[model samples]
Target: MSFSRRAISLCAAVTLSYGVISPAIAQAQDFNGIVDSVHTHAADDASAKMAPLGSYASGQLAESAAEIVAFHAGSKRILTVNALSGEIDVLDASNPQKPTKIGSVSAGADKEINSVTVREDGLAVAAVQQSNKVLQGEALFFDAAADDLGAAELGRVTIGALPDNVHITDDGAYALVANEGEPSNELDAAGTAYVADPAGSVSVITLPAPGTVEAATQADVRTAGFEAFDAPGALHEDIRIFGPVNHHNKPSLDLEPEYVASAKGKAFVTLQENNAIAIIDIASARVEKVVPAHIADHLQVPIDSSNKDDKAELRTIPVKGLSMPDSIHAFTSGGKTYFATANEGDAREWGVEEKDGGSGVYTDEVELADVIDNGQVCEGVLDDVEAEALGDKKVAGNLKLSNVSGWDEEKQCFDELYAYGSRSFSIYDEAGNVVFDSGSDFEEITASLNQPGVFHHNADNEDPDFDDRSDNKGPEPEALTIGHIGERTYAFIGAERVGGIFVYDVTDPANAKYQTYINNRDFTVDFDEDNYDSTKLAGDLGPEGLAFIDKQDSPNGEYLLVVGNEVSGTTTIYEVESVVEKEPSTSGSTKGSSNLSRSSLSSR
Candidate 1:
């Protein structure tokens, strides 16, 4: 059902992107029962950014574990090689509850790593660490012995140190490793992952510049067109290509960042953190640009979020947000290109800094300016970006400000500059305009609120009133991701201060629902559904990574579900069978007299 103009205008406050209408958010709160009605959290969330044993080994965990295999299916049992655990679990979902645990292996000393791959021969190829930290060691190949369900001892071959990733050619006849492992800014840390083979062969790749070679690097030049390459260490035999990262001029962490993915005809790499996605041109050993977002070549990330209880010591550049971007992914759609980065909010928000860095100075100095019509460039822009637009109106002695992007559809740029309500999902178009907002749209949906509100962390419960223009403040999405399977699209959202994932269905693009297990017609399920009609299943946790492996159009032919665990340091895989669609017991009507409308909530 549609709303009258007056009813729809009431939602002017429910803007989709950047301050569409601040008054609406305030108005929702003023409604009382409506705001509190939404309260349902997802199930799994073991996240707590822990101080590492010697600094984190890697962020993007790729293990050949069972969960990984359930998501990526092939003739050979593939697993997401967990660098920390040094083991792989078999993700055979014949039985969902009891995922088989296949034998484990150990990443030799300081080799704490990030991603990994396994060859048809069961040889595990992983990206290990090589630096001052504990995981600093050479990328090695360990033969998997499934005897112990993953605790077996396997032989090893040292490939290269400070490694990034390891790759095996399709025929399995050749293997490659990318080693760009240099000490990260935070000592013990290295930005590079290497590609290597079991024969002790290795190749190092440097970070790619954001706009160094344009659109996307040529696939052939990604690895310099070499069938083979070697590390700097001892021998130089059959070195068909130059080193990926030369000692003297290694690319910055933000530039030419190395990451590998297999595409249709060839292997493509992403210069992550950088603005380009380089598809490897294996023949000539060069990389071609498949995507370029005009981002930093090597992301200039702040070293630490904290420097004691004082100010954070910031670096001299801006690769991402005013702070640092913790994670990133290479995403593409239609004919357009994009990259989704999870920028951990500013350090000051965390409330621990250095004296000189910021003594009582509130970085929350942001003021809401008049909403600009980004639909058309300058024609809609509001003047005075430096000053507030509420006409010198102080909101409880604080300046009034506009709401940030709820969901940008034009996603040409990274999702860092915008504001995604703490643990909210925002989808942008290739052009960077917000297209959907799961948070605002799913209003009243219990799963929508409690699931994603894991991060409404506000030291001060300062309320911002647009009607009166009060300063109601809260946290933003700690991290956000989109996953599409079949005709269904799901968003797994993470909260900053809180733990767990919020699942939202954006199949309709505008209105949506939270993935729920039980069919309930409650205020939290306000987006209609019919409100929990059992179209999809919902799970929870600090889901850092999400994948819909069972899409009909997918290359892999498996009905799978994969969720990355940021807290437990493990990727969970599930076989999501088709949902048995069913309507709830309630009729087509509003259970309570709340201002939230099904269409309005979903539309926003």
Candidate 2:
């Protein structure tokens, strides 16, 4: 549905990029059941200003920042894994805004550490992929005080192809690792499928009691429920297949475990490509169930599918897409376990090269003609002559959906398959049932406040590619972490493309309330269209990992939010406070009742 300007002005509280709207505007706005007034919790102390009190520098060109974890050792410090340099840099963050580099540790020469988890006692586990080859990764442990490479090593356990994520249980008894055995981009001689089997699994690290940290053993849980969950396509016709020629491979062989979270003796692992979540019993090191998180039907769900490069306008299109979650984190509230994911969708490619001589958009124009035409529900997009002209245009290989029904002549909808990600954050119950989804909240909120010429701009660069990211993943909510302050629970979702943190009150997982949005990137400067310098861009860019330190654990006794920006190679920090004076958005009387639509809650 096209949002009228009057509706937008009426429903949205006018907000500037770096400033809050007037009290009258905040009071006038009514977002149906959504939060109306949003506020920023900047640091109260003069020493720390807004977000990014301080930033730790990493690599310049290639994305060096990956994951980060904060723990109080001696004083509060932050540990960040630089994927480009393969170094674990330690920073002194006792002061939130003015963090200084204290020490550094290396994973190896060229190895990339995907993730790190630190316990209260300073025992940390890092998932390191030694080689690009499948199954060459390992789980490495380090004592809290150990600094140098050799001195930090406590023990090492061999894992699978690619250890994508690692998390230590709350009690520190076990550490779970998601080994994403992703297939190589190299295709077979026939150019039909991947060369290596993309079988992914989880590894459990048995940690000794409180004192004996050196005695640790790793268990590979790949074979658990291998037959049931990862059966061949013949056994389950609905199984997702990337390409047609991979019929010889089984689903178990291609289920790449993307991220993992552990709570109450169980680990929740997300299989991004397979669109499933594997619940693992940590004690037995077995998979209980591989629940399929199905496709998001566009018909019921309202999504913004218009090209992001267009001038700052949001068009909520009804198009189906796969909800391939990238980063998953778990939390608990009111005796029930809940988890949230940054649905920054992803896909794989290998068979062919792009005609444009670039890394992205590997499919040639001719191959995408049918899908793009099918992508549109209306008529006349693809005539006999237009089909011949499409050979000159290029599109991404996976953008087109394979199973979309031919265009509906009357309704004028192709039922075209959208991209992979839900482009928002989702909350799931313990049984993997959908509780709440942020829906077009990210798109709507961002579009309402973003400055002109910067909509859907990638956070990584100074050149604002206005509306460039809208076609793919809008905002691309990549990093998610939840923290509790007083009786309220806030979920912070980092938008990788636009460079901001979306705050939502998920205290009630069933009906989460949007709290506020905060971004520290520098937005005052204009884009230097000629020679682009990413560092000069406003605000931090490419937020890859987020660490939410509670008020109690925080060094300054304030709620601390740490974000690692991958493109700019820096770890930015924020001090936030929750000011709850108004009633919850879900409880009060609302305007625009029709606007309160259930987010693509589940694939029907």
Candidate 3:
């Protein structure tokens, strides 16, 4: 089946009794139309309803998808988790453009999984935010791959803290959970999700970390890593929600959720604007440590030592450090598993990675990393390194970091960076260095450097026309995952706003190339070819997450790509064909365009 056709079937559209969750997702059902009132304790009992996909799904394919309104056996589907209205949308994209909303899981703020993921059992788990310091998001586990074909209300398991994300690994030995609590899932729901909330919760998960990895060889793309998105568990945070929400973390619960994940065992997360990536050991249910990474002062690093004049515009970007370690992929190196997040920062931040934090050290005994380039400078960013070997040093009571390092070499540069990178596909090393830094470097290369590469301090900043590496424009991929297309390696990137998927052939990291681009703006049986340019990017598809079912472990060699769009509030599924079965996709995708249309928040 074609990619678009499969994406359309992730969810089927059967009219279940009045339920919760719709585009303008409100507090209760009947949004604008005599909506029903909701009970705070009773979840899975909302009266809201989702709107039909606009004339957008107009092709014959959509008609096919409309028929599948429930989960089916043997079918690999993609599920959408909506944090705002507090619900889940399952799409049976066994057809793409004509994808159908098969089922809807209506719970309360209790079902909001900050992190949503599906596993081989055809099951998906959500970490719903809870209300306490002890617990975070609630864990809502349900059967997705099963095709009983009925309106089933799989009640959720109340996980007390905010379950940021979940992971199901290949070995299946364990499911990893990132419980980013403190304010807890139930703590603050003001900014995220189209809805509002006051608390958070987390779940319990454990995964075996792999062997060790070398710092210098961190950027090598040949290594295969593993990650899992698990379910939220039962439990509540340690704190109550009676007073005004915290204020320090504008978006967070007025608190620095040290780690996006703080579940027992292990956790790793990136703070987009915070300019940091946090790692925690849930063994004791507390943040073990934080890797505060920053960039080098490339601007100050004089390209020519003789040119004494200090260049002004040396660092093109001001927030160079990995803008946000949005999502992380952990792989074992040396003797341990190292988690690396996609640091989507700009050149200025990237350059600072090479500089030594001259004065301000978050801690006095920090192993101040020296910026590779001399004379460069930047503040508030920490040098890269995996979880520092904290032999016996415990910064906080019982909060100790693992000896393993955190990084991604695929996104690294310095002779190791891939030139023919499918821009935006980054790889961070153990020390949080850019082994393959496509996300930020791509911005710099196309804009200031006049090429696709790291943001050079330019030896001198005074020269106005030095180079613009940040000029190139393309899809701004947010979510990433590695998959197999036959025997080849593929990376599925979610371009939420632009509304399409970017497929990359990473069989050879050094020669990582773009393969296919799926158009996701509207039903595409009829689209204006004129509106195909970057600027012509059709708006409002809201693609968020991507997944492909590998029957390789099952009966059929079927592969399905599941997507959760932020705008449509729908999880779309797509069937991916292997290179052997079909040719690799050759189109550039439309990504980064915001899908900020027809959206609302439900306040409980």
Candidate 4:
């Protein structure tokens, strides 16, 4: 099933003439029938100008300096979140080939910055979590155009706890913050119970009008709380509410806002752990509704559910995947708004680890084999024929599932199995109805490439072992951004684990076509987590955030995509080229042939 690199390159070159086709045309031609007109370009086709800023503390997790990133067009500066140092690293991005670190902005020694956003006029706002994350956080504003970036603090306004992400309105009139409200892992003083969890909420900050010097203050800040959903029957049963019972027993505390996307006067916040989206009325500072995300059915679309198969093996299984999206973006087309999400799944695992002298009481993850051995699975639920198919280690036995769901209370056992993430991206309407989902395409596309020795399919960020992450979220698509180029709109999605950026043409939200996949890492390098070296041959790893710079705003005057790689502690700038469609020839050959060879879509 593996193809030579030369053969993949040849396939990519020949497919360049056939631009993306609409879903209707693809269906009419009886195409492979996944997404329409999928294509994967050669590595040389999408080369990037990367700036590898070394890690904060080598060989340590969560110590890498770079995470989320923001670009200020006015100043041509790239502001990146250095969580380890709790500061924003400002880089002069005027030269895309060689970006230099100029200065940094910090609220204080005790503040930890989570997210940042910049306006056209050089106004930068950062979401700062307090030293004690349970306490109220703050939104600190700065004038990035100032001569001294570090000393250009404009002002600060108090917000909710653990403000994880911030986004500015298109008109620059407001700043919306998604306060995650994560609880501390430590137990109560008595060491026998959990403490009260902080309620998750969103804060809307009304920025000063255009050409005004006035700064935003506490009076301009309004909080949107989730208390309205605390009542019984307020939340959908599908929306997860499972956390430490003592602390997160209520929907108000269980729902943690992860990211924010806005359109018109409303904001859509992703509650990752809850597997839902919270709609907020910005002007009124109220949560209108919480809509549960769609569960991915693997029975219709296959997935690689095993790491022990020794190669990329996709198969259908009796399991459902939760679309716990981590990042979301909103765009309007045909007078209607659509939200695109990277369905990177998540689980609720809190409290100190057993290795750190505390019980793992809040973890909800379990393996299928362990669930069966512990007698938690319902008897007679799986017939002998069905059990035999999923009983081996190379099958569904080692697959990870959530222990908090699918419980049959009356029977005291589980009736179904649930996995973490959908391993794809989806488009949803304003009402949260799924318009289109890239079902099994991520894994299928990656597996089809099969680049030997380098860029293994479904490999982990720290290691190049192929199919290593099949048992978990395969090719986890966590970072996402949407941009409009010419008459078409494209969505740039980053796979955090497999280390690449996937481009999709989403002009027609319901008929998104895959454009290309690009990964810069050289897998031959020896990447040992215990003795890591950022300056080695390692490329960008763990893409956590993506910012699209239009041709007009781009420093180099070309469409640019800025990525923040958290694991390798690097920020890369990729030049994006629009795909030009060619008219079909008048020859007797079929124009949109479904019988096109699969090698034409293979990537290297």
Candidate 5:
């Protein structure tokens, strides 16, 4: 129990209700003068609070995480990029729920590390790549006061080809990344080839402040007005690539850039398979307007499509699609400047299944007897050989879809089958428009908070039948961030196949609300009979990335959040505290009602 007495008995102490003041002038009111007589006492004590407070794991079962960044100069480190050990790790979160680890750096053999950035005075950056069919990449840097957790390189620079995410702006001045060109699986003989097409762009990194010498180059951001965002030609022949691969003097070049969020000075990014959003600026690194990101309208937007039975259902019908986002951020609230996305949809193809018969193909699929009839094709998204070779017609539509792919073809009916992730979480306006959207409200709030065969459960299971990712992307919200905690302004998001973390209240970006849902993912253990022992798990799996910090830049003085967990490599750390409601159990006297007590700040 002693982790500082379970972190001071789980926080508790935000009580204030002074009306009948007299007991010797309310005991001469001095607990630092009642915390300096409330100047809106920490946003009225951190409105709608939060809890969790503990978790760390870092690498046990197949270590897989991609984004996370935290700093606070003298102590609270964090970093974490490890996409299967390409490396960045460095924990020691100044103990926000026992973090430890202390080091990591690698990015050498098979290098994969996908994104990290620091700059709170410790200075850092990362993106490192190679295996996304090796178009090559690199950005790596860190000099947090002359390196300790193996962090001081600052020179690899290259860039472009699977960089997938990286940022670092708040006045440290530069660093962006997002090169996601992703393709690679070479085929041919009727299957097509070229997988690294046009090599997506957005690199930047000029960061020259704190104790200089960090030159860092790479800033192309591809232009010619992006040659009209091409993307299609059968999604470049099912991700096979007959197009851009580093812009062959520019013709079509599909914009891939998947995530980068820099604040006010601009940046934004997230082209996630060309469902667009570019913005840029940051002192003229370029690309000032790309926008595109539209297509929500599934009958006024409501969705939960795991294609029919990956259950947690939400539907809404008559479709349109592509809010296809993936990890986005940019915060500010009341003083405006929004941004939040996690639509989590993506596309492109390669192939395998004993060489070209499975997991590949260039997405041209269409056939429920060519669009509809055999009982309107929904067969739990068929595929036992397309539901035993089309018995009642199966393989529905795909043609590299999502430009609003709710297919109708004169009533053949793809009516609401939209596809590719607008499964929810939005809010834009930096010209990206749409100010609020949580439609299907994360599938009716994770099926009214779990337990009906545990909504969407699939971390290799401990019961609760997997349901194969609900046919395609339900609960796939995937990473977002934003914070303020008092005087409103929340956001969070992060679902990634229904694992957890939703918290909304967007301080009125046109009414945001939905305030709670956080998971740690132990779901009764057994990812194949335990031994993965993250203290018998039950939370934090697949969250992919989110960070908050704030209690004066937090070094654990409270108001944290953290999360990382790409399928349980783990990193939890919650503690947004702020509750005080007690006095409601008086009708009878047995004493079993429990209206919530525990003081300094803590709750489940």
Candidate 6:
């Protein structure tokens, strides 16, 4: 995985044929380049198919019992973060269809376990945050295969505040942690702002190689901090640096590290609130550069910007969106590394008196109509046609926009309106340039599906009301991971709200194509947490994390996609198959050819 600059062409292939070709044949031929390029070690007509295999329920609804997940190959076990119980629940996946809870790991009484990962040798690491998240956290290690499962402690190392995510390299040489230093809800003594806001950072720990009896210590921890960006003008103007001023009054405190994806001595961190990606030199433990994420133009990428519209419909609007990516994963394609992100937007609304019992309030979210009524928007910001459309509550008027961005200081008003999350997934090159984006494809594809009772476009995970999350981040692509099957690389993305997985073939980063979309949720169930029946086949809901197991490590000798559903507290295993599509019959009847349903949406 070396970093190299290359020009990626986005031109569509021209079709100039003499014979009359059927649309299906033409479409199949269109994928010839992609199919031919990766089929050196695979079948030429092979494509991916995914379906549910099994599920294990914690019986804890809406409690976030199952969030992050990792697999232990040697032990034949699956580890998931049970945030509600503050523990790691270990399951025996030797029998993939009936994975039962075998044991659990606890980092003492009051610690909150946010993430967990396992090395190839069955060594497990869990990121533990303090009860008060603003305080410093720690990473706990365990022998995952111990008889009592997690009862054998391997080691522990002190980390930064609120360690939200942890990852181990394939070689198991280093462990990376994202310390999301969030602010406390309590107000300061002056009652003007938050009590404390710690500076966010990334902790890189040098771990002992596999089979080593020694453990990582505090001395092995090296922090990648943002102090260098604290200087004025160091951060780009496009990188968001707003919210109630922290006590430290440094830009470092405002830049929270949300997720990390590393490769070849370089780590790419998602600064979700800042709308940027910070590249870190892992060897030097220093910030290299912060690349601002693209702000999507709604006119070109249509969106459903209003929940009040009473239906799910994509429309062109006069607005831009901040692509605040949450989870990112790195993969190599054509000998170059590319990063894929789930552009799940977020809002910084902290210390609300009613919600958190705080004395003060701090938020950057405001309604588009509110900004207009308050005279915070410029007089001629919207054209006559744009004004009429945006003035309707069923359109962009009810959409949520960031008040901290698009401000014209000299004019004392906002010249442009910005929304949260682009509501899609994107592929970025080494330089953080957008190689490809699934612009509005997630919403449109989900809406076109015939899954009437199971899924509703833009609906919340807990409530199946249509268009409920439209005004917010629709579908909210938050979970992401990459896998290789049959010489082709695929990116699996999960929608946090609608609760499903979208698969794409990224063998060619510039020409990624959609493969399939599968969701296990049975929306017909009355989702009442208290009286919910775990035995019912309600399916998994609120997918928070995804892990892809190659066929070599799979228990059933098949590719597997594991999903940890936060809302339903269930961990599901989906068997992925690479099937060869059968050619049409000579009698003109084509049926049951094993060809998976591919999305018809156009690529960006």
lDDT of each: 0.31, 0.61, 0.34, 0.75, 0.57, 0.77
Worst 10 residues of 5 by lDDT: 1-10
Model 6 agreement with the true structure over 48-94: per-residue lDDT tens digits: 75656667888798899999999988888999999999999999999
Which segments of model 6 are wrong by more than 4 Å?
A: 1-46, 189-191, 245-249, 352-359, 450-454, 534-536, 581-604
Winner on lDDT (3 vs 6): 6
> How far off is residue 375 in model 5, in Å?
27
Query: 88-175 in candidate 1: lDDT tens per residue?
Result: 4444433332334343455655446555555544555555564343233444444442445334334333433355555555445334
Which numbered prediction scores highest in TM-score against the true structure?
6
When summed lDDT is taken over every stretch of 10 residues in candidate 6, the lowest stretch is: 32-41
Q: Work out candidate 1's RMSD over C-alphas.
A: 16.4
For model 3, residues 505-524, the per-residue Cα lDDT tens digits are 54444334444444333221
Off by over 4 Å in 5: 1-75, 79-124, 127-140, 145-153, 161-198, 201-252, 255-271, 274-315, 320-342, 345-420, 424-443, 446-500, 503-604
TM-score of 3: 0.47
Estimate, for each residue in 1-54, the C-alpha lDDT of model 2 and write its tens digit: 211121123123333233431222112332111112222322111111223345
144 in model 2: Cα distance from truth in Å? 3.0
Q: How far in Å is the alpha carbon of 47 misplaced in model 1? A: 30
TM-score for candidate 4: 0.86
Backbone clash count for every predicted candidate, in the order shown: 127, 17, 188, 0, 27, 0
